[model samples]
Target: MRIDLHTHSTRSDGTDAPGDLVRKAKLEGLDAIALTDHDATEGWDEAQAAADEVGLRLIRGIEISTQFEGLSVHLLGYEFDPTHEPLVQELGRVLGGRNDRLPRLLDKLAGLGMPLTEQDVLAGARDAAAWGRPHVADAMIAKGYIKDRDEAFRDWLVPGKPAYVGRYSADLFEAVRLVCQAGGKPVIAHAWARDSGTKITPELLAELTEAGLAGLEIDHPDHDARDRAALAAIADDLGLAKTGSSDHHGTGKGPAFHLGANLTDPAELERLLA
Candidate 1:
């Protein structure tokens, strides 16, 4: 099966609606796709319904915001029950931290004289705190705050950049345990990039593997072939499953990546299903 295991929808930072994403996957000849929305499983119902319509298999998933050693560690949860309460509670905690920290970020920016506000981000957000910088970037772009997301992050959004806020209270090990309790396999998202810095060391990988990490996202838009090779080797040495995908988020993301373009095959889907 043509499976794109990693992707987003408006339920998180992605521009497409849940059902629309399924339709787009169908158009791209994808046999299976996972609705790995960031920090929430709210899109699964709509995604499943849409997948039914398009005859595409929708793997229920979530991209959780977690941490290890004060660095952001995005955990991908796959093949879990949507109604799983433990997962629900933990996601709520993670997102609640997200909500709380974002405002603190706004407050920090204001103190720094940037004058950015949560209201600015919320106006563009589809709902609650499920979205982040992208919405702010779009609003900034719309209001001419910055040229695009790249400029937005470089100028105002990325960590250590002006107007950035730190998100604390993210316990990555607990997130892995929660996904395991929810019957989902948790995978560490894109590492080996300059952005991750010291976060992707062998020791860190070992710690996460011991903490119940099931896989590593070796294929991604940011990872070069050499990086992927290093990650794949690490996954093998550590006995973690190796996975790949284009983290598609519609037109908002740059070119050369979209649904099914860079994908994990059916065999991997079968492995995930198992």
Candidate 2:
């Protein structure tokens, strides 16, 4: 069966609505797709309903932002009850931080000579509920702020960049706990990126695994052959799962990879859902 366990919707930073994502998935002939929006479950109800309409199995999921040793990371939660109190509370804090940071980032961008306004971003991000970089990037693209998403990050949105601001994020251990407590399987999202230097080390994976890390996201647009080999080795050594996924974010995110583009096997999905 074709399954893509990681994806987003406009509920967070993705470009499409949950229903649109469902339609796209069906067009691709995906057997299943997970609507792992960031830090919010409001989209889940819509996604689930749409999945039922399209006859596609839906996995309740989210990609929560988190921190580990001061670096930013995203935790993927699958099969979880989105309203679990503790998880909800933690996600609230993250959202609050997200809401607060965007304004500061926009101001910072202005200071750095980028002509941007909150209204511009708000208008562009229309349904993004929680403010995010993608909205800012869209505004940037519209305003000719930097050429595109990559340029925006390279100039102002990346860590330590002029417009960079931090959000209140959970640690790897806490993120894992929340996912498990919410009855979800916790997986690390998109860990194999060598060009931008986002590599998930074995030691880091071990630490998270000790704290209930369920899997590593070995499939992503940024991962090269070497990156995949290293991730596969790390998963083997640690007895952790290595997943193949597209990490699709609609268009303008480079060659749109489909649901099963990088999947190494189907066994892991069955094992996880079990």
Candidate 3:
């Protein structure tokens, strides 16, 4: 069965609503899709309902914002109890950081002569539980400031860029512990992408494995063949499940990140769900 284990919806950075994302996955012939919206699980119920309607398997998951050695990390937690108190509280802090950084980011952009109001960003965010850089990029797109989210991040939003702003994130090790405590499988999402490979070494992966990291997202839009090979070797050595996914964000992300662009092997899916 085809399974794309990472995605987002309008409850976070994605442009599609929860139901629409699931329905589109069905159309794309995906047997299963995980709704891993950044730092929030608000989309779960709606997405699950749609998945049931379409006879699609829905993996309820969350992409947690985390930090390791001062660099950003994304942790994907699958099949967790959403009401797990510690995890819920930590997510609240992470979402708060996203919201807290907005004005500063906008102010920096304004200084660069691309003025925007909170309303502008919020309009783009729509049903998102918290505003994020993608929403800011959307505002920039609407104002003709940038062609797409990629350009916005490449030119302005990414770290070391003009509009970049720091925000609080959970400690990566603690996050893994919390996911495991919540009775979930914790996977590193695109662990070696977006310059994160510099920090996510084999040594680090081994360390995180000890901390209950159950898998690695081995195939992603940002990972080249070399990156995949290197990560695969590490996963093999550590006995971690290897996952593949589209990281779909609907129109919010680029075309290459469409639904089912990459898929988890059925055996791997069984291992992950085991």
Pairwise TM-score winner, candidates 1 and 2:
2
What lDDT does candidate 2 reach at residue 193? 59
Worst 10-residue lDDT window, candidate 1: 124-133
TM-score, each model? 0.91, 0.93, 0.98
lDDT of each: 0.78, 0.79, 0.93
Candidate 3 stretches with Cα past 4 Å from truth are 194-199
Better of 2 and 3 by lDDT: 3
Taking the tens digit of each residue's C-alpha lDDT, what string does model 3 give over 1-274? 9999999999999989999999999999999999999999999999999999999999999999999888788999999999999999999999999999999998999999999999999888989999999999999999999999889988899888888999999999999999999999999999878555354778888999998989999999989999898899899999999999999999877787999999999899789879
**CA shift of 231, model 2, Å:** 1.0
Which prediction has the highest TM-score against the true structure? Answer: 3
Question: What are the per-residue Cα lDDT tens digits for candidate 1 across 1-274?
Answer: 6878888888888888889889999998888888888888788888999999879888888888887767777889898775778777777777776677767666765675556667777777774336576876776776665687778777777777777776544588888888887788988888765556554788888988898888888888878888888888998899888788878888668875677767775665566557
Which residue pairs show backbone clashes in model 1? none
Q: Tell me the TM-score of model 3.
A: 0.98
Tens-digit lDDT track for model 2 on 1-274?
A: 7878887788887777888888788888888888888888878888888999999988888888898777678888888887789998999888888889877887777788776888888887757659888788889899876787877777777776778777788777898998888788898887755434565677888988888887888877667778777887888888777677777667536564554465535788876766
The alpha-carbon RMSD values of the candidates against the true structure, listed in the order shown, are: 2.1, 1.7, 1.0
